[model samples]
Target: MKELAGKVKLVIKFFPYRYRDYSRIAAEAAIESWRQGKFAEMHELLIKRSPKLDRDSLISYAKELNLDVEKFTKAIDNQEGAAIIDRDLKLAKELDLYVTPAFYINGIKVLGVRDSDYFKNIIFKELENAKKK
Candidate 1:
C-alpha cells in the first residue's frame, strides 16, 4: 500500500489537475482490492475500462501539466520502474501489511480502508505522539 500509493502520487503529479482526482480513484480502487485480501480482483479493476490507451488519454493531461511526453513515455516504459513496486512489496512483507492505503506515521503503522477524518485525526495524533518522543 505504501509503495503503490507513493508511486501513484508520483505518477499523478505529472498529470493534469483535472486527472488527479480520476487517477486517484483508479489507484484507490486497486488499493481497496489489496486491502480486501483479493489480489486476483486487481486485474479486474485494471482491465481496460477507458476507451483510450493510457497514453492517448493522457495527452491532454500532459498538455495541461506542461510536461514533455517523450520523457514521460521513456520513464513509463522503463522496466526498472517496477523496482519501486518491488521495494514496496518487500516493505509490506516486513510490516505485515496485507492491504493497501495503510499509513505508517513515524514507526506506527495503520492498515486497511479508513475515512478521511480518520487519516487526518491519526496524523494529527501522530504528530502529538511524536512530540512526546
Candidate 2:
C-alpha cells in the first residue's frame, strides 16, 4: 500500500459506526465501474458522493505528501488494489456480516461500529473464551 493509503486507513479506523455503511456496495460499484473503463465517471461519482475524498486531486496530494507518485497512481489503476477491496468484502460476506464494519468473535456476530473500544471488548472476551477450548 502507498504510505498515504496506510495513513488514510488509520483515519478511517476512527470513523463513527453510522458513517461507515454501504462500504461493500460502494466498493463493489467502484471496482465494477473501473473494470468497465469508466475511470472518469467513477472519479466524478466519488467526488459527488465523498466530498472529503477529492478523487480528482489525489495524485497531486500524494506527490505533496512525498509519496511515490508513480507507484501510488499505478496501484490505484491496477486490479490489485480493487481486488484487495473485493477480498475484504468477500471475507465479510463469508463471515455472514451484512452490516458494514461488523466484527465477529469465535464465529459469533457482533454488530455495529461504534468505536475501537467496542471491537476490543468482543475480541478480548473471545480470546479468553478460546483459551478454554
Top candidate on TM-score is 1
Report clash pairs, candidate 1: none
| Per-residue accuracy of model 1 over 12-129 as CA lDDT, tens digit each | 1111123333443333333333434542444243445543325444434333344454654444444323444455556667876655556665555667678867766766675577
Best by lDDT: 2
Off by over 4 Å in 2: 1-51, 105-108, 115-117, 123-133
Candidate 1 overall lDDT versus native? 0.45
Please give the distance, in angstroms, between residue 55's alpha carbon in candidate 1 and its true position after superposition. 3.6
Candidate 1 TM-score to native: 0.50
Q: For model 1, what is the alpha-carbon lDDT of residue 132?
A: 98
The per-candidate count of clashes, in order, stands at 0, 0
Identify the runs in model 1 with alpha carbons over 4 angstroms from their true place: 1-53
